[model samples]
Target: MTRVLRLAVSLALLLLAWEGLVLMTGVPHFILPAPHRIAAAFAARFDLLAAHAVITATEILLGLVLGVSAGGLLALTLTASRRVRGWLLPLVIASQAIPVFAIAPLLVLWLGYGLASKVAMAALIIFFPVTVALFEGLRRTDTGWIDLARTMTAGGNAAGWRVMLYLRLPAALPAFGAGLRVAAAVTPIGAVIGEWVGSSGGLGYLMLHANARMQVDLMFAALLVLAVMALALYLAVDRLLNRVLPWAADTTIPATSR
Candidate 1:
């Protein structure tokens, strides 16, 4: 397929550049391992890498599910209640102002050096973007649609919840999907950072251990695996979003100026 070929070519070019840099600089193996050295390291330690990668992947997946569920519920509640929004929206906005990594240590300390901390970190990181995107989408629903819904339900005891479920939720799916894409892309950061701060397992933990032992090639191999995992997760989420909302997926403008 064309997409597969393009990806392969891009990877080859990057590997060539990396190999060139190593040869030109005469970097030591401990400092900058060549592509072949990294490949050997990956082949030698495949089992170790696979184990750690599974832990990190589980943490990321759990975090994403928790974060998306919480964010969607909060967005819906916020939309239905101006009073709740008044009380909660400022806090939500303020939370984003603080650097997430700054609180990594606290999360580790509170949750302990286990999967819980990493999952919490990822959920926290994903929470804001999804909530904000969906909330804005719900808020910005076309007034015409809302008015029509209101008129139809006027005779009945229709409440705000009914309006949101019947009208705003449908209108907000595209925005929600966009938020999910962003969430999926960044979800690994929280897990990896949590591992870096304090963890017994995962790729970040392995990278730290390898670096300390001067196993640069192994560290590079782990890094490559992490990148591949992140890319795969993002692509999977993108495909799911496309399948769920094909209209949103297709409603994109061409990059070139018209």
Candidate 2:
């Protein structure tokens, strides 16, 4: 409750400051609409915003699922086979060298400006972080634990698979959780960028049309919605990670100590 109240207060203050700035500057509404104007626009276009927001949210969620699954699978494969890792890791690293914005147009061109393009963009943006985090985690699993497992298993043929399934995967989950949080934070960027490049529906599409029409208030409203959506997704991911990975709790110093 306290946290919620603090957030509300902070937002209210920000809006007030924004409104005051616009009033003082006497800027045209097309350039920078006041907060009240933005609120009015949001209220007037609630249905339109909701429709586009649903599309954006769907793309983000689907992309997250696909990225996480593919990344996890690749990490497992790389961990299980040194030859595959040697061949594939360089390619994965190289892929990130090309900026995502540069690829957005190509994705839209290939995927045809649909949900597929947006989802692919989002998945590609997050894939590297998840793969690297999980791969490192798997690789860095405590050697002592592996030694213990080896001794217990008596070096049988099934020992390797058994150790991996029971020991390595569980130990690596905390790192994966870290990667997932990062992916959640960035997932929206990819979807929005793809939509910006080309899309029939989404908050990014709405923002583009609103800007072209000089509906600055509406554009701000769409931006606000996107910000809220991204924040909510990140918070949800953080909470879920905390709940799922209790053993990996954050080790921040206390405020008093700091």
Candidate 3:
């Protein structure tokens, strides 16, 4: 089956199971509304959902752009300069030691309860993976390639920069693509956490209000929307990476009976 068809079938099965369990258990709607109830809530408040979704989407996109750019630059810097790496690498590693949730409040306080805070949160979350992946890729460039480049530029003063630009950068694309996929997957968590901590808009804010009002169905609808958004973003990024980095083909081995 096609991917879309498989996804549809899976969703249908899950909804059926969920509805069946609720019906059999006689659970209260507030506790766990039936799928139909959630659907009703979704349709009823689509306008509200759409408005908040746009804000969240904007934050995620902006964050992704900023994160990828900064991460790529940092990775290049770390690879190119040992002195700088010694100073910056530890700080980068230390930053990840703190939980993102604990940092959300501080980000809100610093950047304020606006788009800035959300964007920063998402970028901060995305930074480490991208930096590490690209740095390792750069560092692990084939020694044979480096030797060839050095021989070619035996008398040139700019040999290092030339090799970095022509050889190392190309080799690192696959690793950077891998890190980008991860960054895209986790992009939503940062924005939503920022919203949950302090925000006037976005799906997280909507869900928070819905829960406070005991609108369980509406809350579920918002959560569903967030899931769909995250899935769509990740798929889009994956497809883009596959197209852009055509040489980085998947090499996963299929399972077979012995």
Give candidate 3 misplaced runs (Cα > 4 Å). 250-258
* Candidate 1 backbone collisions, by pair: none
Those runs of model 2 whose alpha carbons end farther than 4 Å from true positions after fitting are 155-158, 250-258
Q: If scored against the real structure, what TM-score would every candidate get? A: 0.94, 0.93, 0.94
lDDT of 2 at 15: 86
Instruction: Order the numbered candidates by TM-score, best leading.
Output: 3, 1, 2
Give candidate 1 regions above 4 Å deviation: 250-258
lDDT of 1 by residue, 89-150 (tens): 99889888999999999999999999999999999999999998899999888777888898
Better of 2 and 3 by TM-score: 3
The TM-score obtained by model 3 is 0.94
